[model samples]
Every structure is written in structure tokens, then in C-alpha cells.
Target: MFESAGDVIKPKGDVNAPSGLQSVLDVEEAAEPVLPHFFPDEQNDSIPRLSRDTFLDILDGKYNEHYDNKLIIDCRFEYEYDGGHVDGAINYNDKELLASHLFNSPLEGRTLLLFHCEYSVHRAPLMARHIRAQDRTVNAECYPRLNYPEVYILEGGYSGFFAEHRQRCYPQAYVEMDAAEHVRTYLRFW
Candidate 1:
């Protein structure tokens, strides 16, 4: 389904996926994910799933054999992210902007892109879906092949992951998005 270089994983010009890869827009409109993902949805958009334990493994270098690097994209409000986030995670909440940048970016290397918000529910999945859609459009003529094919969503999101892996977080703390104390901070973020 994909072609792998030392740093960049490119899909083979030809791929044989069961569902026959297509853009996310094929199933849903250009709507961002809302509400929590209490149950899995039917949109099998091909975005891979990554477990928290496996996330830790990747951080510990277990996936070095497959991915040369990884990027943790925290898609929460700026305040929520600033309060606490995965170590080394970059805060990028705008899906449209992110997609535009990723498609046009000159970033090199094969890297696993891990996306998440408070829960691995809405924002995270939607952003991943958007990126895939934009990627499809960018390489429409080429079909299934993509510039960066290794996109994943961290299961249970940061809340679940941080609960068990606090030691791995930057400041070893987790902050809820609705915390009362950040009311003033939220305004600035907005």
C-alpha cells in the first residue's frame, strides 16, 4: 500500500487496498469532527490507529525499523495545549491551514505523524481526515500514492495516554480543556 524510504514513506504508484483508497470527502462533507467518538464510525478513511502503549514504543524507538522519525500534532485549543501536552508536540489546531502547509511543505524524511486532542475523538481524527483528503487532491492524478502516507491518530488521545505516561510528558502534567482556571487564558487563545 506504501513505499518506504529511510525517512519518507511514499505509496507505491500502484496499491491494492481492500476498500480501494479514496479521499475522505468521498464519504462526508467538509465538516470538522464534532462530539466525542464514543463508538467507531463507519467512515473507513484509511487513517491508521496507534495505541498509547505503541505510542510509547515509538517514542522509545521500537518503530525505528519502519519510521525514521515521528511528529506529534496536538490539535487542541492553544490554551489547552500550553497548559500541558505531549512532549515535543507542536500545537496546530487549524485543519485547513495545516493541510495546506503539509501538502506544500518541503519537509524531508519519512516520519509518522501522530495527531490528537483531549480525547482521540473529534478534532484529532478530523484533522487527520482533512490532511488525507487534501493529500488525495494534491496527488489526484497519481491516485493512491501520497507525499506522506504514515498518518495516525493516538487512540484515547492525550488524556488517556498522559494518565499512564505522565513521566514521559514535558512537565509531567495533564490539563483538561474545560478547566475553570484558564478562563482568562482562553480569551487570549481565542
Candidate 2:
């Protein structure tokens, strides 16, 4: 009697439904809830801070097979750096000079970057933060944003490192000089 009009379609039983032909609403309802993929919203005060021992390990190649690309920036006066500094550290007293150097030669594939002054309290963290800011701004302009290497500030600065690893220090000038005099001369501001 129902076939007199033509043909009538009937809903299939759940057992007879096609394997991959489920309705969109049913699929969505059955799917697991999705979670966001992003960093937590914790307030980052500044660049990451590395302890003196950790910094020394990086310098000594404990973390990587090779330590050639690692850079240690000494953000102190040129005279102070010349007097004595870390073995392979580069002097960048002025922010402008540091920024210019970073712009000219990007640190894309570097393994690690360490920044320190007399005390890691101020200059090192400040410069590290500046470098991070530059990376964010400059990478934004590129077609595919560049991934900057991680930057760190030495926790206690050069003084702390020197006290612990005097053997790794360079030039013998500062190492041989009077410790008290050195503190008064270079670390007075710190």
C-alpha cells in the first residue's frame, strides 16, 4: 500500500549503518574534547636564569657534544673586561652595540647563550631580556618566524663563577689581582 506512491526510504538500524558514514553531530558528540596547545599564562618576569654550576657545565661541554656555537656575553665596561673576564666571553657594554651585533649575525642555530656582568643581578638579565625582545620583534616580520636560541643570565654573575671555577677564567690579570680590589673596582655598582 505504501509503494503505491513510488518508493519510500527508511532509516537503517544501528547494526546496518555504514562504518564511516556516521552523522556529523553524532561524531562530534562522541569525539574527545580538544584542549588548547599553548604555553601557560604565568607571568614571566624576565629571561631564564641559570645557576653558576649550570653555566659552567655548558662551558665545559657537559650538555652537548660540541660547545662551539655557545656564546657568553660579558656586559661590562671594556676596561673591566680587558682586566679580566670569562675565557671566551665577548664584551658588549652598550645595548646599541649588542643589538647591532645581534641584528647583523642572528643566533638562530646556537645551542646556548649566556649573559653576565659583575653581578647577574642587573645588566645580564637586562641584556638577555633585550635580546629576547629583539628576537620576538624581528622574527614577526619574517615569512616564517625564526626560532631564537634560549638566552640565560648567570645567577650570581661573573664573580660567582670566578669564585667557583677560577681555573676556567682567562687572562690571569684579574685572577692574579687582589680579590678585594677587584670587587671595589668593578663590582662596586653591583
Candidate 3:
């Protein structure tokens, strides 16, 4: 199945073809980006899913009792937010803002932080790293290890989210995050 914006997320080749399609895949692989899965098959129900309809429903009060005042952070570009975003999500422009927000916001209570940006996987995780680092820097009321609040990466990123179920207004741009080593190679070559 195609991700919302027709960005192929699977192994690039056609999975449906009994004979796997092959192509030159060039996305830079990050180091240890996908952490070891502690729960193999088990689902973590704690991570919230914010689909278009569900987001709208929450905004319309259908799920207000369960969702009101929870934080939803959209990491998309400014134009994207101005064009449209889920009803209540506040925009955190880049990784820096993400870190600052995490450092400043109270982490003691029940709040959900949903991070989304154009369906690319790297930005959210980078932002997560910054957020986690903030926990260590501050004398967190919530223990950094024991009970840090939950932060979620929106499935499919922004393109996946929008393309999967909603109409996208802007042409989707592909932003790839390279591993540190690859970045070094660029610097060396140039």
C-alpha cells in the first residue's frame, strides 16, 4: 500500500509482485536509529494515534473528555501550518524549538506530545533525542528514567499522515536525515 503522499516507505521494490522488484535505493541509513524493540509483538497502547478524523473528532468534542488540553506539536514548516494542521496542534518549527519546548514544559502531568513533520522519519526522532536530553539537564519532577511523559512520533510522518487519509495542499518535499558518518563523508569530500 502506498503511504498517503505516494512516498514509497517499504523496501522500495514492489512487495506485491511475487518476484520482488529491485531498484537502486539511496536513502541514507542512520546509525542505531531504530532502537531494539523491547516488546517484540506486543503493542504499546500508550502511544496515541492522531488520524485526521480522530483529530477532528477530538476538536469537535467527541473525545474531549479523553483528549482536551493534551499537547500536539506539529514539526512541519511554517507554511504547512498556515495552510492547515490538526485543530489544536501547536507548531514547533525545528529541532531547536522542540528541545526548548521540552525543557520548558511541565512533564509531571498527563499530557501527550505528538510530533509530526512531512512523513519523513528523522526529524521527529532527532527532536525526541533533544527532548530526552532535556530531561537529563533539568531536575525533572518526573524521574528521567522512571516516569518521563510519553512522546509519540506520528506514524508516516507528515506526508504519510496527510496522504493516507487527507487532501494535501502543497507538493510534498522529501527531506532525508543522514547518519553522522555520512555527513562526515560529505564534509571530507567537499
Candidate 4:
């Protein structure tokens, strides 16, 4: 169906649907960017996944020993983020904004990225991959080199992390995207 608009999110037969951002002035359906569990090795993915405990380590300054500079990215919608998230995470749901943030930051190794959505299943992984891919495109001359080489994703995502490490979260409340209150209170406006 996305044949004419560059097919950036081409699906291979029926097993998967590869999605990404390709802004061309609203000419077609804007599919959500979701990275499937079985992302092919061909896609530009060299990012690492971290467990909840390890994520806590990073937050507590145990992982980097000094905590230098780390960026926790919560790629959830505004309402879900306002509901509750990692204390310092910035709610940036757009891929382009994420790429801009990563690309502009100097390659100092101090700014580590911890990207996650409600499940780390689709949204978060896709955004991380997008930034890495953009890095590759611009860094082609400097092959095998990336602006922010080592970015990370939280395994089990915030849902699992919040349950085990409630103290670490700010406000410590979890809100699903399709919560009844949200649907009744806000979705009608959209």
C-alpha cells in the first residue's frame, strides 16, 4: 500500500511491517513507527538492551561510576508521560526530534541514552533505531563511526521497571495508553 511514497516501511511478505519517518508533506497514511521483535540484522541496529536493574544502576550512578551525563528518553505520549515516568526522562515521542538530540550532542561518551516506552516492545526500539540509522547516513564517510555509538533500550520497559523499582520512579504511578479515564476524558477531543 505504501508503494508510491518511497516504501520506507516496506513489509517483507506478512511476517513484519518495517516502519519509519519519511515526511513528505502529508501525502499518505502516517503509520506508527514500530520495530518488530525480530528486526533483521540488515537494519542499522547495533544498540544494546539493558535490564531494569542495570537501568537502575545507571540512574543511581553505579553504572558509569560518576553518572557523568545520561539522557533518559521516555517515548510515550504526553498523557502517559504526565501519568508517571523515570524521574528525569524527557517525553520526546517524535523520531526526528530524537535524531536531532542525538546527532547534535557531541560524541563525548558522557551522554548515554536510555530509551523506553510503555513496553520497550515497539515505540522505543523504533526511535533508537531511527537515530542510529540517521547517524549512519551522515557518517558514511566515517564508516563504522557514529555520533552516539552506544545507545540503550530498557528491557521489559517502564511497566516492568516500575513494579520492581517503585522508589526510583517519580510519583510512582503507571498509566497505560488506553486507560479508561484517558479515553473518556481526553480522546474525544482528538
Candidate 5:
């Protein structure tokens, strides 16, 4: 059995015992914590979060003078991304590929990196944790003279952003779907 405390899912049984139970665990023991999807009960101070309006402002060049570089990564599935996504945002469905892109890409000059998914709850946080864990290695190799960019997750994900700035979205066909049907279809994973 499993019990959910905020975003962390805890096993009801002895998870540490040497048995067949290891594979079932979703999180591994590590110094840096890995967060689950955001629930009303979960409170984490490590992962920085950005509001939808703030993100929109950034996109509108509100912070252009302050931030020299910026990147918005959308971590949804290919189809969901194909359906609709933020302008200029890159789609990276696989975590491994995202990691590789971060490692090989030029990010030292960047000042901000924003990550988001359908709900800005689970996948985004998970990816942020992964990047934080690998920060040291990336800095050593990728940014020898520069500093790491400030990373943040969209507080409500694409859903929240879309709710507020529907005009900014692309692929009208996907965004024009029936609200109820769209929710049922896209949010089925939740």
C-alpha cells in the first residue's frame, strides 16, 4: 500500500528491506530531495516557482534588460505539445534528452530557465530536481567562466498560463477544443 503526504508518496511497508519491493519505489534515497506533483498539502522551499503573469511579462520583454538569456522548456508529451504550447518554447518529452540538451547546450550565458508541463505540478518539478542534482557536473564542464541560470517552474503549468493568456497560445485548432473534452483528454494522466 502507499500513502501520500503532500507531494511525497510513502510506502506503507518496509521499503528498505531487501526484497522484491525495491523496484516499486518511485523515488530514490539521495541528499537532494526529489519532489512529486504539487498538491495543496505539499510545501517545498527549494524549487522556485513563477506565476503565470510574471512569465507573460517576461515573454513580453519586461525583464529583457535584467535577464540576458532565457529559455522556456515544455515537458509535456509530443502530442500534447503538438496540440498547443507557449510561443518559442521547446518541447522535450524525455528527461534524458532534456538533460543532454542542458549539458551540451550553451546555458552559462543564460540568466533564467523556466520549466513547465500540463499542470506545472509533477514532471516539471521532477526535471528541476534532476537538473539541480547534476548542477555541479554541468557547471564544471559547461560554464567554466559563467554562472548557472536561475531555474523556476510555472506555478500552474500550461493550464494556468492558457487560462490567463489564451491569445498567446498557438495552433488554434487544439486550443479551440471543447473545454470539458479537452480537460478529460489531456488531463487523463492525472
Candidate 6:
């Protein structure tokens, strides 16, 4: 007498359910994507899945210390880089001419490459794939933002730098202004 439910019943021994309709929960879960086993766990539709802590370790020189020279590439536009970026990142934004500048940089096989963008958007992974396709055996990875050991998305791009590690990432600049002092300073200046 279950007249209200449309999909509460499972046909006996039936296993070939449509993937499009799998959201009903009763449908079988699809096998995971065929990415590498060590793929980062922090990924989403927007961000790639990467281990947060492992990302930090790499940024902090753990991988470089162990391996030879490594490369960290910033894939944001020129204007974005002009604003700010990770201390030593190399700028690789060539605008709409993606084909012209693609693979122009000679990445070292012995080096570990880390790719970052404002939010890792089209740039980070794009470069990663290009790098891999060039030499299938090259060692490479990507990070949209840098929070270390735990790679994180820059919630507000570079502005997020202060939000994530206000005290640590920017020790000298994130000065705390007292509420009264803040109001007085603003009012007095105006």
C-alpha cells in the first residue's frame, strides 16, 4: 500500500541503474574516478583533492629538502601577480593565447612543480597536465592556495592571506586596532 513513494522499491537482482538518476540513494554508488591513488583529498568541483598537511610539507621545503630543485609556478594573470603572490612563484599567465605560451618553460625532470592560481581555476591543473604530457615521468603537483601541510583555497584570493594566517603569514601588517581607537582614527582623519 506504499502509494506515495515512487522509487522506494528495488527490483530483485537488478544492478544496472542509470547513473543520472543515482541521486535517489537507493541507486548503487558509482566507482570513484580513476585518478592516481595519492590524489589529494581536499578537492571539490572547484578545487583539486589534495592532502592539506602534505601540501604544506611540500611548500615548507620538505619535498625540496628530500629531492633536488623544485618549481612553484603562479598561474594567475599579470595584473593579479602585480598585486601579490607566494614569495618566489614564477608568473606564467599569457592571457587568452594559452597555446602560444603553453610549455614554454623548461621544467626539470628531477624537480617538483607546484602550481597555484587565485583559486586554482583553469590555470593550475592546465599547467599540470601540460607538464605531465611533455614528459610522462616528470614529478609534478598543483596547489591553488598555500596553507601548508594542509593545502587550502585562498578563500578571498590574496586577501585571504590575512584571513588564514593573519599572525603568521603577515606578522607585521595585521595590526590590531582597538575599537575606540579605530573609530577615532577614522573620524579624525576624515
Q: How much RMSD separates candidate 3 from the native structure?
A: 22.8
Tens-digit lDDT track for model 2 on 1-190? 4754343465436756566444444422221212111221353555667767677777777766542367789987666688779899998877777877777876545346678888776677678888877766775534233334456677777778778777887764453223554666556455
lDDT, residue 73, candidate 6: 62
What is the descending TM-score order? 1, 4, 5, 2, 3, 6
lDDT of 5 by residue, 56-156 (tens): 88889877776667778888866667788888888886677877877777555546778988887788888877776666565443332223446778898
The alpha-carbon lDDT assigned to residue 120 of candidate 6 equals: 57
lDDT of 3 by residue, 52-130 (tens): 4444444455644542246667775565565556556687766766666555665554445566666635555556556
Task: Give the higher-lDDT candidate: 2 or 6.
Answer: 2
Give the whole-model CA lDDT for all candidates, comma-separated. Answer: 0.75, 0.65, 0.51, 0.72, 0.68, 0.44
Best by lDDT: 1
Per-residue error (Å), model 1, residue 48: 2.3
Please tell me which model should have the higher lDDT, number 1 or number 3: 1
Whole-model alpha-carbon lDDT for candidate 1: 0.75
Q: What is candidate 4's lDDT per residue for 1-190, written digit by digit as tens?
A: 4656556665457654434533344333322222212333544655667877677767777756533567889988778888898888889888997787667765464456779999887789888889778977986655555555557788878898888887777778998878887886446534
Residue 53 in candidate 5, Cα distance off native in Å: 1.3
Query: lDDT tens string, model 6, 45-162?
Result: 3233434345455557665544455455666655455545565556775433432333355433334445666655455666555544433332122222111112123223333443
Shift of residue 118 alpha carbon in model 6, Å: 1.0
**In candidate 2, residue 131 scores what lDDT?**
80
Model 1 TM: 0.71
* True-structure RMSD, every candidate: 14.0, 12.7, 22.8, 15.9, 16.1, 15.6
Select the stronger candidate by TM-score from 4 and 5: 4
Task: For candidate 4, give the lDDT.
Answer: 0.72
- TM-score (C-alpha) between model 4 and the true structure: 0.68
TM accuracy, model 2? 0.63
Question: In model 4, which runs have C-alpha deviations exceeding 4 angstroms?
Answer: 1-46, 65-68, 105-109, 184-190
Cα deviation of 149, candidate 3, in Å: 1.6
